[model samples]
Target chain A: MAASNEFRTCSVTGLKVHLPAEALIKANAVVAVVFLAVGGLFGLLVALTRWQAVHILPAEWFYLLLTAHGADVLLFWVIFFEVALLYFASAILLNCRLATPWLAWVAFALMLAGAAIANVAVLQGESSVMFTSYVPMKAAPHFYVGLIVFAVGTLTAVGIFFGTLVIAREERTYQGSIPLVTFGALTAAIIAVFTLASGAIILIPTFLWSVGLITTIDPVMYKVIWWGMGHSSQQINVAAHVAVWYAIAAVVLGAKPISEKVSRTAFLMYILFLQLASAHHLLAEPGISSEWKVFNTSYALYLAVLGSMIHGMSVPGAIEAAQRKLGFNAGIFGWLRKAPWGNPAFSGMFISLVLFGFLGGISGVVLGTEQINLMMHNTLYVPGHFHATVVAGTTLAFMAFTYLAVPLVFRREIVLPTLAKWQPYLFGLGVAGISLFMMGAGTLGVARRHWDITFSDAPLTFEYPPAAILMMGLNGMSAVLAAIGGLAYVLVVVGSILFGKRLDAPDAERPRFIPRLPTTVAAYGSAGTLHVPGTIVLVTVFFMSFVLYYFVNWKYLSEIWPMR
Target chain B: MAITSPEKRVWWNEPLHRPEVIWITIAFLWGLLMFGMMVYWHVAGRQNLSNEAYKVFPEKFAEKVEDMVAKYKVREEGATKIPVVRPPPGSDVYVLSRLWEWWPILELEKGATYRLHLSSMDWQHGFSLQPVNINIQVHPGYDLVLSITPDKAGEYTIVCNEFCGIGHHQMIGKIHVVDKK
Candidate 1:
């Protein structure tokens, strides 16, 4: 039974914020940032080592750091932030108390402990088995145990989220259905459950095998089941980040989806078909039938891709519609030109949307094709594709949300506003460069996760094209630039939390977070006639690029030695 | 509106915008096209991954590779002692992947097709043929047999792209596709 005093009305957004939920969000977010810093540093080291010219770190440290980099960033940082998002979307948005605050704290403690244990195991030099672990290459037993513990903790937090949702419904916190962002969060949570379950199924057996209790862990079976968790976890990211895209549109521009049905249906498509895309990883592997590969990799005729395409249009369309209504109606591109590029939140979200669609979305579809995968499997292109999706798309979107959340959730004025304004572009451009260069190198047959692309110490020598080595050098430079941007983000966020002015204080001046619109402007269904011609043109360009790239990959495949 | 509940309770009944309808239709059709292309490629395309795989013991697979090497070893590759075996056209060729090397370098005549058998002795390895740019996942205990036709004559490098261990970068093999007379 939480007291009424435990809730405070936010000065901005006018949403009722639960104190416990806010604290939990803050704690989870801070820890997520901490992991991001550590992981980003490790990533920089890896990129430098991969650069043929620099070639820093011995072979042993390269693999070790690469493993740690993947774990800390992909698993710890992203999942921790998602847990915070789950809580935010449920309790705070619903204007209800978080279900079992004590239990939520316990979940957090377990996650912290799990993350620490995994890090320690990796640091102990016994668990350099990379993030996929791909059994038969046994890591420390504690590595598996730590991951299991982490997954259990995440599962507990998800339970609390669902419980809070129930409480919100029971208490009748608001009218009608849950908000679209919350619905999107629900989609992510559902996917998370599936992901965690798959992880438990594979990892538990692997843990036993690591301790010598089990023998003959089949490698093929490990990959099949492992990707069930591995790739599905990424699906969770897709759903969550799309939700953030929607949330940012609402907060920044007070924009509604052109049609709730259309948007919600797109999210529904993700839940139904996104997990099937995991088959792409196994497309080049044997022991899997071509029938299974074709069916699963296409996601039953690319319905999930259709879902992404929908978001690709609607997100920008929503923004365009909102801007048009605000009288930025000079031409098809006027609204975009007049957009709030100076605001980090708006700029970050917009950059994320565009780059994600162009670089990540297009490349992913091409790479996932069954035959096309033969050309790019285990290449630097794989990492290039993911950096675009996970880092540029999801992480940038999260950073944009943080710009809003710092003031709204943490109730602190952002420190170093000037640096914050430029952070997104700096980070976004650097990441885009990394993705492009890595893919370029991969196109030239540069192997990923190898210590030396030059193969300086190999018995039989092979030379990569000079262009591939050049791409690696550029990738290393981009990584350094991205690392600086990451550092700026950490400094701004931490500095604001510790030393910036408190918005909640009675004496403090509250800056208007959400700009006030005209009285006549309705919040929903106000974009009459939906004349988003700009977005239409944009998506058309995207379509053309996709068509070009998809066919180009097939052309590349055709040039390879004939195989069947 | 995304942050709050919908203004209408019956939100599903709302009409979709014309652009959304058009985009969805185009996107769905594009998806179908992509799917059709993959299926069509299987029927018409020359390059397709072979689904032929078998379960075998590591020791047994190693023995087969040794047999292939003994029967067809032309000469030792310069500097490295790895045997470069030239199997007959349309023969079953074996290449075993282990901790740090792809053993028994292969030689084939251009325009000659052969069933290439690949399996890892331990752990999983990626058989990434460079210059030609064909890659496949090789797993222990499972022999993946790909039908390979060297259409062009050149020296090809087999790069072990999968991270097997510390010596992964050093694990390289060669394939010589001699021109057909």
Candidate 2:
């Protein structure tokens, strides 16, 4: 085993001859990881401010931080990371380089400028608008312009992604079949295209409204279209999360699912139905006709959920099968025994999957229901649900992938392995604790974004049992733990980026392996691989979600509600 | 990483065969059971506490409004359940109508079933019950009927939950759940 240090330079072709596809994506991912870490801090601060018995910030400052948190986490952190992943799959994973390097730089510059504007406006007293900022709750014009600018940058980024795909197709690099990871990323990019398109549609008008160019914009219409952008972006997050999961399990663990086909098809389903699922957010809103609500909410969303549930069942099934193959004796949790708990990547993935299922998935389904939305709408439970998904699910997965990504891409070794090993556990436990506490408080009728609960010198009126107060306190403790865990993650990641050792050779070489089963089979597995028993169950679920949408609309939107 | 050579098995490939299949099935069944219990508990609790039998809307005061036709006689929409003016504030019914506004002029009763049918003829409004923190949407085409039963008699504020407009923060309604006069 000889360590070879060779400096590779640009060839006559004007591209680095030795740079691997994985290395490029991983490099892009590093920038995304840093941004996500900073944005997550803002997220944590906002949560603290919101949950503190008394707000941590002055009334005015509280609103500013709120704006920053939303802009950073919701818009910048998630989307940028997703874009990096998109580039990774399209260019590197698909054996191609970015179509135009200059366009990528332009996208980055515009996003950076937009983020600066949004942040500055937030810090200034001019933009105190809440994250929703729903028209008429005016913010400074720059804030809206900043949002528009950022969205435009994202559009350019997306154009580059498609360009890569076109270039890849033309080169015939994806000759046989698309890799599962690329397939998943392609689906996410498609979602992003629609998502960004909706953003341009809504935000340009909003920017004009902020500038006083438009005096009248119907709040209802803005809301409907806003979900097309806002909620659709979240769906992109969800799709990217699943795609990342497959990549981690297969690439890192050398584990292929029972079938690739099932996974790929599920990715397609996500593309088809994710946009429609946005109606879940508006289930309890007023003035939407029953027909429209029913069609979008119950029918379309349920189909998307069915796709999710299929993945939900199949992913774990595949993992269990993989564990058994590792030669662990068959017991209830024998698979756990064989699992590489010491490995940071494996542990993070494990914890992420568990939390995603137990917390995020369950909360999403319940909140998606029509009648249930009545209690849950605008409650702390709403944020709690998303936090579980975005932070615990997607963020954790990203952190886990970083264990492999940092070394592979930046040629840097993690500074402290021991700290790195425990980072996931600390963070995972803290997130789970916080989410649970939030869920409990939500059950007790805790509202969201209220500056003060003890209103008008009246005693704080609450209907929760005595136990719920304890839960709220627990929620506070969980917030503290989460803050600590988040701090640790930042330290570890930043330490590695700045001071970690450079890799020599083995890591530089892309390890070769046999092709797994076709993604279609890997997706669904031995069970029909297409029209399995699970498909029937999925169809029923799709219809049920469809019916639920109509039932809620019919009950809530009727001119004369049956209250006699 | 690139695939250089073909191998018999894929990297860390996990195949779901009979034994693994049986175990997954059992675990899924257990999950289903737990899910069912959670659903049952949630539904049962909501149904019992939220039904019309619990209380009526505007749990504070009682009112007897004149018929729409006569303006003097109590309008007979129908006569089934006797009008129970809880804490029996008065016979004068205060019907205040305002969108993006709240009904502050009201006398209340303790544990009285006053059918508070909240509706907005224009844009959507939110009627959030004070103390309980329960908020419902009020739309032009829809009426949100609430049964309010105040366990304690006191002055409480009803805040708007929906973002009606710039005045949403100030759109506060008052309800005095007075002792029987």
Candidate 3:
């Protein structure tokens, strides 16, 4: 199974490297992409069904597609890509051998098994808990079991990745500090481990209960505990996005942050503080003390967001410094004018970060607040907010990273380079459109997880005004854009796998061109390695402001420090 | 320890004072804008709701209910509480019905713009208006308030949106919108 002569072994943490870890990551990413498309398809279908009140599929089939969409895109596709990223960050970037090749494969196998089981269960019409799996509404026992086993498998994968990271650090894998990309991924894995642990608590019990092992059930308690599992999973996804940002910054733009210590510290903060951010979801739920939600949101989530914001500034800071070094002196904005926007890698990095930081980031903060919770809770705005972050921010970042991973990891040349360039625009526009529609519909009080509004007795009518119908139509159009963009991704990836030029030459023979921004100024230093003390202090002061706000606003605690 | 030294720094490092401030300010401004928008939406939503109770249904249905209630009122020895007058097609009415729990309940009507104040004494209940698909969350301590006007006339089915244990799905209510003669 080990193809010895084909790939080069890393000197950092010596283990015989047969398959390029990049290829494994790419192959897995392809799988994730396929699942993402399926999820997107189901999302569009659900939207259509809700809008028109047409039963496209029977209840069983509808639920199956819904379940599959949640598992595949939200769960399977996202986690698989994160795993691929873990391997890249730990092994490939650090020039280290994996801790155990067999363990890596085992992780992959278990993930596949879990995905297959979940998919089959959904197809057979057994499990449909609407992704969150709130208690009392039980799915088949196998469904819960499958989810548990799947989570365990993914956690094991996290363990293996962590093992590689630790060994590389101890063994002096690289000459200097760990690369920023790897650091981001390291944080993501740390967050994932904790998040998955929450899943273990709820799924196991839910599984046991489903099999009639536990007769009595309290829905309220179950809801409280389940969110510990449920909400943290989203935190892991956000962490993955942070990692992708650094990866794109390095791999695509060949730009390194100005300060390694500052960047890594920000990532470390994300690792430590990300879990508490789950309180944002529990803001409006009854039984949870308002004080708890308030503390969680402001203290934990706000800190994590602060970490994200630090990185947000750092990403562009690195790019700007890098551009300066390259002698692009038009102005601060001149570097942007001069930078290589045409390159798929550069564009992806820039667009994903911009969207994640602004649109997604703002919505996240508002949702984290107490007063805003009354309006946005469980409404269409719920999906509106997530699609901005998960789909637009994290997923888009992964897609951009794929442009690099496909070639390096998969050993396949990109088929249509130009079309690849067009994807971010289309996907971004689609997400924006969908989010607006959902936000507007939320204003009109639309709920999620219902087959149709007609199913409810709210006396809602089909005769929507021009603005509402326009919003719905806009959402549909955005779905169309998303489909096209997703198709473009598949075509480039799959086409390269089947027909593109395969590099049979040695590692040295491959072209090594990490594209740089067009305009380069030589101001402070290489953005990759500058010491920016002032920025760090500023961020600290900014974070402390939130802490100060929390102290004064105890009633405001539910928004941040949620207990439920 | 050696790698951590400042001497090992790469080329692109610079202070982010300018960008950081600019971005944070932009975010703050956007936050204000959203808050403004949210306030507008809340007020607009409230304005759209009606505070009036049961408006007499269309011309046809109002006449039938009036006739039926009047006949019952005259036959009874003392049914003084019964309302028998032919209300204008636009007039409002309020009444009570026992839901799945056999508790006294009051519901709002469609098209009859009325402020329906609903509450359950015994258990948690869901007061959902059919055809409109608006669900007013109901609980023991707090009174649920909804100002609604049903645009369409029909038999609207109301089911509980909340999980209130067994027979939850069977919890149903009706709103009769009488047509004007």
Q: Give each model's whole-structure lDDT.
A: 0.90, 0.59, 0.59
Q: What is the TM-score of chain A in candidate 2?
A: 0.85
Error of 1 at A508 (Å): 3.4
Score chain B of candidate 2 by TM-score: 0.53
Each prediction's TM-score versus the true structure: 0.99, 0.76, 0.74
Name the candidate that leads on DockQ.
1
TM-score of chain A, predicted model 1, versus the true chain A, to 2 decimals: 0.98
Give each prediction's DockQ, rounded to 2 decimals.
0.77, 0.09, 0.06
Q: Pick out the ten consecutive residues of candidate 2 chain A with the lowest summed lDDT.
A: A1-10
Residue-level lDDT of model 1, residues A1-564, one tens digit each, is 579999999877678999999999999999999999999999999999988889898899999999999999999999999999999999998998999999999999989898999999998899998999987998999999999999999999999999999999998998999999999999999998989999999999999999999887888788878888999999999999999999988888777788899899999999999888779789988889988999899999999999999999999988888888788888889999998888788888999999899999998999899999999999999999999999999999999889888888989988898998889999999899999999898899899999987778898889999999999999999998888888888988899899878899766665434455553336334334668899999999999999999998998888888889
lDDT of 3 by residue, A286-402 (tens): 345545665676534255666677677777766665565566656336667787776666676677776666557666676566545544556566677778888888888888878
Clashing pairs in 1: none
For residues A228-247, what per-residue lDDT tens digits would candidate 2 score against the true structure? 88888888887887777776
Ranking by TM-score: 1, 2, 3
